[model samples]
Target: FKDATVWTSEEEGILVHTDVLIKNGKIAKIGKNLWAAGATIVNATGKHLTAGIIDEHTHIAALSINESGQNSSAEVKMEDVVDPEHIGIYRNLAGGVTSAQLLHGSANPIGGQSAILKLKWGANADELIYKNSPKFIKFALGENVKQSNWNSYSRFPQTRMGVEQTFINYFQRAKEYDLKKKNGEEYRHDEELETLAEIINGERFISCHSYVQSEINMLMKVAEKFDFKINTFTHILEGYKVADKMAAHGVGASTFSDWWAYKYEVNDAIPYNAAIMQSQGITVAINSDDAEMSRRLNQEAAKTVKYGGMTELEAWKMVTINPAKLLHIDERVGSIKEGKDADLVLWSANPLSVYAKAEKTLIDGAVYFDLEKDKQQREAIKKEKALLINLMLQEKDKGSPTQEPKKKDQEQLHCDSL
Candidate 1:
């Protein structure tokens, strides 16, 4: 990319009229007037270049967002249900989102494990996921976990306090299971307990769905008892109430910008949630729990500036570096710097502005979404569809055998949609 206004998502600040070079799928250099031999140059004049948006919480690529067969579904993995061909992948690419955490839904107290994706279009499931991916599991609190929407009167944890007991009971069982396994005692392998054991051993992290402050504090206390910290609290609408405690406990907060009153417990949610958490020294990230909202995270990040007076750079971090930090993938992405993966987006204007649109989005130095290429693809698809329909009509005139038409359903799910 040549002669663009670069926001490095680092302390180096914005570099105007800067040139960036990508080689071997990594950022080669950033300087004034850079040139590369045998390279396809992108004319980035009058454009803004920044690291690709990292959605800390999303459910775009997965087939099933929840595993609610039991109170704890830690054994299930979201990677198993990943739909790489989902249009959301291409849509997210067009929106400048290069990576995302495809987390499980908030159906159970202990939701299924998560999948980390790079948003690589047309790739297979295994290729879409990162190699040696960090392990993460989803946990939940509040109404969803307690069967508020399901109307299940027989559910075990039908109240808020039972939610806390669910965590304690599982963690205690996992502790005993780990101790017995460590002692070399031969026992049957249990996938569910094994996952909980990983959490107890700090081998896997937890991204919890939270709302009220009391449950947030409850889980933190339980984690402290087990000697582990919660990695992130996604949809933590009421995080501002316990920002200091969260900062002290060293848990990251990934929250919405101004989502409120959608539910009863989230009444305390405020637009200043992210800013307040950041001010208290907590790593804060802006998240999109919905598919459409995920496409315009820049606008969500910009909300912090309007509501709580965060700087543009700080607001940008809420979508970029801060999410990278929460996902533990900052070393490889989330910034424009030498020796990092070249996950970048070229925007038409200031990325924090509502009018800004992604002209080009790249992952690992490969262009995944371009305005011109997208137009070409749309035209080609139209032509192909016309040809196919013509052929089908000819077949129908020839009295060819056919089955009844069936409508396929493509359900769009979010953290609590199920």
Candidate 2:
């Protein structure tokens, strides 16, 4: 990218009139008038360039987000059900998102393992994964796990206190399983226990779906009892009330920009929650759990500036380096620094502005989304849809059977879904 205004999202911050050189899918250089022999130059004059935006939390690319038959489902994985053709992947790339944490649903206390993916649109499922990314498990607390929204109470842990005991009981069993295995005692191999043992041994990290200060404190205490730490608290809308405690526990927070009051537990959620957590020495990242919101995470970061008086650079970091640090992928794709993956976006204006559009998005030095190309594709899609509709009308005129058009499924399942 030549002669672009760059937001490096590094300690040095923004650089003006810079040129970034990409070679073999990594940022090879960043300086003025940078040139390479036989390199394909992208003339980005007067454009804005930055590291690709990261969505720390999302449920895209998965066919099924939950295996709700059991409360403890650590055996399932998001990668196992990934759908490479999901349109959300391309849409997110158009909004400059290059990578995301594809999470499992919060239908139970212990959910499935997560998949961290690069927005390599049109690639196969395995090719889209961020290879060797840190292992992360999903844990849900509060109403969702307790079945507060359910009409029946057949499941275990139907109350807040019961939820705490469920975790304690599971961890205790997992500890025993680990101890026996370590001692070389004969034991049955249980996938669920194996996953929990990894947490005890610090082999896996937790990104918990949480709300309400009391339950948050309870989970941390439970983690302390089990001799493990929570890596992050996703959807921690009420994080402000427990900022000091979360900081003390060394858990990062991945939360919505300013979401609140969608449920009873989040009544006290404030727009300043992210800033409050950051001020208390907790690493905070703004995450979009919704697929549509996942596309425009830059606007989500901008909200921090309005609510917390955070500088634009600091706000941008919340969606970039801060999330990278939380997900343990900072070394790979968070900033436009030398030796990092060339996952970047060329924007028409400052990314913080609502009018800004992602002109070009690249992942690993490959163009995944281009505005001009997208325009052409949209026209083609319109023609295809029109042709299909005309055929359907012809069939109707011939008195053949016809059915209503299928609606796109936009149903979102949160922690409280029954």
Q: After superposition, how far is residue 18 of candidate 2 from its true place, in Å?
A: 0.3
Candidate 2 structure quality by residue, lDDT tens digits, 317-370: 999889999999999988989999999999999999999999999999999999
Candidate 2 is scored at a TM of: 0.95
C-alpha lDDT score of every prediction, in listed order: 0.93, 0.91
Angstrom error at residue 266, model 1: 1.2
Candidate 1: the clashing residue pairs are none
Worst ten-residue run, lDDT, model 1?
147-156
Clash pairs, candidate 2, are: none
Residues 1-418 of candidate 1 have per-residue lDDT tens digits of 8999999999998999999999999999999878778988988899999999999899998888988778999999999999998999999998899999999999999999889999999899999898788899999999999999879777789999999999999999999999999999987899999999999998999999999999999999999999999999989998999999999999999999999999899888889899999999999999998899999999999999999999999999999999999999999999999999999999999998888989999999999999888999899999999999899889999999766868998899887666
lDDT of 2: 0.91
